[model samples]
Target: MIHLKKIKIVETSEGYGEEVLKKGFEFECGHVNLMVGDQGCGKSTLLRMISNNSKHLEITLADHVITKGIQSYYFDTEKDNPRVKDPQMYTSLSGKDEGIGYVGALTSRFRSHGEIMENMILDPLKDAKDCVVILDEPESGLSIKNQFRLIKEISAAVERGCQFFIATHCYPLIEAYDVMSLEHWKTMKGEDFIKLAREKRYDGTEKDNSD
Candidate 1:
């Protein structure tokens, strides 16, 4: 299984730049790391940076270090479509295709938005034993029921040795995972964080930016 020990963003270019995350923002990795914060708080930007295969970043795995994380699989909810069969898309650390062929075979059965999103998030877990799967707001089209169901699927994947880095605003997802709050780089736990998040959303206290 692939184990990411740490990641430090030393530099970033374009779109929000270093303001989103300073040069020294070092994050200790988790089995299932959830990046949570208000909209445009650099959640997606951080994910993009990790998947950019940048040379300026430092990625430390359990067994070795790498300059670029090209082996990581990134799925942007707004940009990446699971229905599209792109066999050359992602490759696992084990040097195998990250199951895009399976997506082609199964995407025909998923016609709804929720189904597509579900397939997008779950299909990789099928063969991603030593792969790092990064997902950006996968709950965009999923119902609340499916959101919780996705959480369950994630937990199952974790047990199977697939590490996840998910960026989302879904309360259930935030409450269920190990959250890295981008607001202050503070970690928030269940219940209280959810309460504060809800209050902020209803009272118009949190600022929303395009991430």
Candidate 2:
């Protein structure tokens, strides 16, 4: 089981220079910890820092080494500047690159993305010690069938004692994975946010418009 014991970011120069609070949240062993928040509540920010990369945030881990050991993966839906990047605070944190051992999953909207994640990554890494995965909206472009497959893959990985750090707005994830809703996870929860994610799962788009 891999759990986060601490994450304290004081003054990270890697991200936009702003006074960031020293923050840390703990998780249970080998569980898929989902973060649901509004578009700008820093859910992604918190995930990245947990993944060992947060710009301008000072991060200090209670356990640099875990019982399973220390490795991580990331699948960023928005894998570009301003959205995802190596936290500049790297230099100040430990004087060593925290992202060094992490495996960053490919960011693409291709139909085979789910397959790639299952076959190419999770299958191989699940047995390895210290492996963590960060899935950011893994279902963005997948069809309903494919989305189900992704869920299966994630569930399987979690069963094998692999820790997961995920950021997503997908409703299926919220329900299927039983991920906590944004209202529950984030301080800001609205009817619209919940409705949108729910609709995505049932595909309430056309119905909503017609009504």
Candidate 3:
């Protein structure tokens, strides 16, 4: 029901300018969007920008976030120490329009992937309002059944007023969360390198294979 309303990007040197990306280069979106990539693109960067802003505005390229991640994360640990604040996540225009549920980490709950996706992840949020949920490479840890369950969860979330912005290099995830694939995100983190992203998320004429 509610949208981000205004999405303005700030200027950065040697990259797409804010005006051009919003008005021209980038096909802008809101709470629910999907991003795909080949190897190295700016997908993660965009997600970080979106998620970092806690004003009912969310952008996520990864599976999860740690709140003000730039200053809060020090090698996967907290610095400023911001935990999952549910109301804050749902205080935006988007949240009021949708009945959203905000939970903390999905990493600490289950022992198996299936249990994690169904019971821990999807089951809990099935009734929550979710105009969007930004997820990073969810396929990295899930099984095929788990992935399918994830798809079910996403579909349910969308039907309930939630959208998603997911970042992934996995084929199954791409197919599962196939509503959109803006592009890939490229960045090196802790000796690892990510490749190009698809929409500025992956852009292609191919339709997603999932229902």
For all predicted structures, in order, the TM-scores are 0.75, 0.54, 0.48
Best by lDDT: 1
Per-residue CA lDDT of model 2 for 77-142, tens digit only, reads: 545211144533121111233331123322322325454434333344334334567767666656
* Cα misplacement distance, residue 122 of candidate 3 (Å): 2.8
Q: Lowest lDDT 10-mer window, candidate 3?
A: 71-80
lDDT of each: 0.72, 0.50, 0.41
lDDT computed for candidate 1: 0.72
Expressed as tens digits, the lDDT of each residue in 18-118 for candidate 3 is 21122222334544455554444545545555556623233223223233222111010111111322323322222332223333333323245444334
Query: Residues 1-211, candidate 1, lDDT per residue (tens digit)?
Result: 4467888878766654546776777888888888887787788888877777466578777763354433567878876665554544745435665556665647545578777676666555555555677889989889898888888877877777778888988888887766887876766675566766665755666746556
Model 1 poorest 10 in a row by lDDT: 63-72
Question: Pairing residues by index, what is the TM-score of model 3?
Answer: 0.48
Candidate 3: stretches off by over 4 Å: 5-10, 13-24, 30-32, 54-120, 176-211
